[model samples]
Target: MSEQGQNRTMVEVHRVPPTPKASRSRMWTDLYSEHVDRAATSLGDAEHCPAITIAQLGSVAMIRLDLAAGTIQRTAEQIGYVAEPTYAFLLQVSGTASFSHYGQDSVLAPGDFTLCNNAVPYVYASDGPADLLMIRAGAGTIREHLPSPEQFCGRHLRADEGLSESAAQLCLGVCEQLASGLPEAVHNRVARNLLDAIATAFAISFDGLITASAVLTGRHARVRLFIEENLRDPDLSPGLIATRLKLSSRYLRMIFASGDETASAYVLRRRLEECARQMADPASAHLTITDIAFGWGFNSAPHFARSFRERFGQAPRVYRREKLGVGMPLRAVGAEAG
Candidate 1:
């Protein structure tokens, strides 16, 4: 991905000294702590110098990494939301790399891909020289195109055939284009199209999987029904549901593995939906949005407001105002947990 070689387009290039192998791990650790309040480790020969190049396309980053046989890991202790949360999509270019995240593992060869969540612990390793294209996009930014990206992360995917092939081809072209330059508009549009292609591909793949298994469909339905019935329970969670349903938490999650979201995410969405329903109810206009949230098992007002906005595209106050008619204010409620 050097800026010099192939039919270079119109890119602006900057070069610096090669990063010293002995110091890179420390550098990455410091970077993680400073920005994301986490830690990362790079383990490889002291003489290995990684060649990394990065380009920004709108809010997403396209990076080319040439690595020696080594491992980069974020441990359980390093599991936390990034300063600006992102989902990392790694496309293997040449050689092989293995990625482990969300308790799943994928070994990638050329033209293979895997997705990783920045907020979770993960390991990326290679046995020898490897070339990769790493695409990092904000969590919310990704959801705009792929609503349940979790289903695709930490799993082996291909860029060689099927619907995903278009995404893989687009990404590879864009990565190469980064060395040369594309207009800002061109790159951004490329980013959007790539994401859209991935979402469509994943959706079709997921539908195929689910449609092939009636037992999975039934299990998922039962779990969801239980969640709906217990929406008002403050302690409702995947683990709790598993215990009540006599299923292992891992199995409970697996039932949702082929779906758009995990079991825990479904719980949050249900709670939010219930709260929205109450907020829009004429009789519940007497209650504040906070009250509605708490009634649906949310305990923290700030957390509720943030989650609501992310899901519904508006602040709770604004949503209520519009639902109740503009200029209308919520009536005060007694025992409001104020």
Candidate 2:
């Protein structure tokens, strides 16, 4: 075999051939776990502890993550200590994965696709060892169409339900082609085409089909759920939300207006309340005032302080110190003043 053929041999493809049920299940479990471990190590850090194998075919990085038939525990600290920015397209070839992102959790069964961002801390646990195919793309590329590119900074999004099947098939086809070891030029072109298709799939998946009102409504609900779940994202705004939901700015406003509040107000209230609750928690004594504020989506310390004072009766620092027993050191109080 040539060097190219040798590279191709590194990738193992399962055709889902006819076999006894027990035999197939065992084979899948082993393959999926090995693949996940390999891919996780290849990405930024083993600390991310992703058990998967990754293959680079041109611009696309194809990952086969083996999720053994059991619960896999993941935390922001485990995946990688630092938050990195990248886009991921995940396709489930077998079994299921329960994903938790921005406090919302969903189960993705076989043939389902999800868009995941590495900018946030989240966890995904599988039902058993399952096959997961992932494609990574640059941040700039995925950001262009996002209403709040930052909102997706650390989030996972499922393709609205209608588009999941088609997206899964397309991703599977791309993975198969990459595994075949085409010429470099052909591979690059194919990878780019696949990326475009994947992005389009995401765009349509989140926004729904333009032609079908029912489809659009369903898509709209998913978008709303995302917004509701991530209300503390400081960068959350109408434009960003609209872009992700694939709605015109005016229409997005109308959608929000139809409810009791405007989009911006809803996001702001949610963030403020979340921060207030965190500050009121006695267990949060170890965290600084700014840390609590930032964790709940307040970007500017002064702004958060001001907002807290306005919403409550005192500054966040004072509130935490007095109400939550988070005693502030003199140095820390001076830092907040400055």
Candidate 3:
């Protein structure tokens, strides 16, 4: 939010003076958890030197990380606290890093970047020295303009072509403004414009993933219908679907390629979505959260809890209460456990 004509409050964090290297890893983890998203961090095969810069532009945060080889993993099981969802736009300013998110893997070259949804699990890793830029914004506002943001997140936006190149230039411009401490008085407008630009870039670059109505065939419809009917089957999977449909698992994958997630990920997401839906329904209010989860094909309670929390940004019990409120019965599932 390097707003034009307005000064920004630059926030910088560095290593505490006189600390042992053996404790550096823990220190880095603490700093990251405090400043950024909750995650497990390690320098990993490189020196412990790490630097962070945070510039506040109202609700938007511009962050810079200069570090050596390292990895940071954010998991659902550890996402205990409740918070609003966020969208992180990570740019690789220098060096390289590989990322895994939304059931897809992507390698980022310099000038490449990716968008991330904070309500889900993700892994960010660098093999060597790297400089990274991240712009974080509230997910609610961003989601308003783009329906079904899944098609955008976790896909690499290369800097060499199309709308992605335009986004890269805008991001670089923000960086320049921040570094120069320019009071341009355009922070709010810049943030909004940046989000609009990035959303457009992702939509245009990965348009095929969403416009399924144009290319969806009878077979595709059948696959989807089959998934809907068998959602309660814990063993339901791509291979099983392909076997029953007289198709190869490979072809199933190809058909689903028009969407963002793989076939398996799609099934899991659907299950979670359904679980959330039922938890809020008045008729299902009597059912325990676990009962709903198990009825929806979840086999492991712990895994379901973790996945639900990660997907919904809150624990199952918390979600149930939020949805049902005091209307939830004393004997209902959420009353006893989360």
Give me the runs in candidate 3 sitting further than 4 Å from their true place.
Answer: 1-7, 15-20, 213-338
Ranking, TM-score, top scorer first:
3, 1, 2
> TM-scores of all models?
0.56, 0.48, 0.62
Give residue 322's error in model 3 in angstroms.
48
Residues 27-99, candidate 2: write the lDDT tens digits: 4445444433211111111112224455666656777665454333222333444334566677778877766
Best model per TM-score: 3
Per-candidate Cα lDDT values, in order, are 0.68, 0.56, 0.74
**Number of the top-ranking candidate, with lDDT as the measure:** 3
lDDT string for model 1 (81-136, tens) is 34655887788988898786554567899877777766665667787878887778
Badly placed stretches (over 4 Å) of model 1 are 1-21, 24-39, 81-84, 209-338
Residue 195 in model 2: shift from native, Å? 1.9
Model 2 TM-score on a 0 to 1 scale: 0.48
Q: Count the backbone clashes (under 3 Å) in each candidate.
A: 3, 20, 9
RMSD of 1: 17.6
Q: Higher TM-score: candidate 2 or 3?
A: 3
Superior candidate under TM-score, 1 versus 3: 3
